[model samples]
Target: MWGYMRPIKKAVFPVAGLGTRFLPATKVVPKELLAIIDRPLLQYAVDEAIEAGIEQFIFVTGRGKGAIEDYFDMAFELETTQIGRGKDISALHGTRMQPGQAVFLRQQEPLGLGHAIWCARHIVGDEPFAVLLPDEFMYGSPGCLAQMVAAYERLGGNLLCTLEIPIDQTSSYGVVDPGERHGAVVEIKGLVEKPAPGTAPSNLILPGRYILQPEIMQVLGRQEKGAGGEIQLTDAMAALIGSQPFNGLTFAGQRFDCGSKAGFIEANLALALDREDIGDHILAYAADLIATIQKGRGLSRDVA
Candidate 1:
């Protein structure tokens, strides 16, 4: 139909995880508040939503996540200091939201993504809403959320971002059983979360970008625990497979798995190398670093 059933004006970011992978630092700072270059993880997710024409940002947070809210509010003391020092604060441009555009709700327990999303039900109301996982960073043309939105307009119903991974690695993500392919989008027949290794129907994995109908939220209310004895979003999504038009978009762009230490470093390197301001410098430095590392390995081999 080439049009969305309803305008997607709001996006939900589930940022309540303990982020134990990045402990110590995360103990003081929420993982979603961690920066990718100069912007926080949550900020990139928000910016992606903005590109998709989203007007509201709803955060499902837990304990020790107050900093996320503060980051969006005015800091009179900091602004005053910057003004007095004649220091430019333009970096903060587009960072603050107009009143009522941002909302934060506490997800009282560490249930699961489905539970966290259910916490924002009242705010989400009865329209389709987006769910973005801040830790899954994606940099793509049209942006991840925008691409999913575009596909939603054409297909209508449930749609999410998908990337093909090695088959054996499918156990690490929710696997989609594809029924048909249309260009970069795959029609979804079903979804299995973290299937046993070698048992996944397909390698395409869901990486935290979704346009789900309001019905899924109703399914989640049942709170049935799936894989990890938690209210799994995959289980709820599975219930809506044939009832509506559902599919996945193979978004075009570089994606970074910022959920781990290695992925985070890789994302930093890849993104830095693509930046106009730092590309050349980082390229030269990386080249030199690789050369030196290779030389050291050669010398060690000769000694052996």
Candidate 2:
């Protein structure tokens, strides 16, 4: 069994990013609160975690992120009103957590993803933990982390959910140096964070899901600023390869990068189009939009 493979009863979600790209909308509303359909981005993440048998939900948030805490708490007034009206409480199901099951930590600075994760060290204690970036949505049956947990049970050190991106685009992510290939799992030899074009070790880029050993906390503690003068978790993870057996699991699912504007819109449309409630309508609308765009482009070309 993977030495690092422990039942994933807890998960850490780092939601302290400035979300500068979203700008004023995010000034008051945490980007994690952005909705894809009827549920918020954070809600989808929490649901995924819950499905993976995660009992404790840990969020490392920043300033102006109080809404995130309230989102999981009991909305007293709303609940009271709903009860007063004798409305079905089922609508509120899955929104509230059992007392003490969910915890929140504040990452005072926007140092980096590593810093945000470090803020959760106290709550994580000395156990192997799972980290999920809310911006990266993984759609699958067993769930992304669930699969990682399974792989971890077999391989044991540090496990990351990796996927094959184009080689030219490897520079945009943490690329892994592949060692022994065993089906979907690959022994991780080394990791390079945002290597320059053509310098990446391999096209296997680390996605946002990870299951790491507690020893990583020590590595992050001593980690110096890398790349953009901010401590990168990838750098710290790279340090553990020689000491521990680190491997990457190529998951079976589609991962949506909800961090970018185009990706976010695409995720919204894709998920909406898959839902039985909205699929037909959303698909028709998308088809109409595409046709309109194509016609407009054709007319413009003819005029030119």
TM-scores, all candidates, are: 0.95, 0.94
> How high a TM-score does candidate 1 get?
0.95
Model 1 vs truth, CA RMSD: 3.4
The lDDT of each candidate is: 0.89, 0.87
Instruction: Report each candidate's C-alpha RMSD, comma-separated, in the order given.
Output: 3.4, 3.4
Tens digits of lDDT, candidate 1, 1-304: 4234897888999999999999999998999988888888888889999999999899999999999999999887998899899999988876788999999999999999899999999999998899999899999778999988887887888888889999988998898999889899988899999999889998899988999888888999998998888898988999888788788999798788899998888888888898999999999999987898888753244553
lDDT of 2 at 90: 79
lDDT of 2 by residue, 1-304 (tens): 5453466687999999878888888989899989888788888888888887889999999888999999998989998999999988776677899999999889988888888888888888898889999999888878888888787777777889999988999888889999999999999999999999989998999989998888888988885888788889999999888898888899898888888888888889888998999999998987887898888753244553
The numbered model that scores best in lDDT is: 1
Instruction: Give me the displacement of residue 206 in model 2, in angstroms.
Output: 0.9
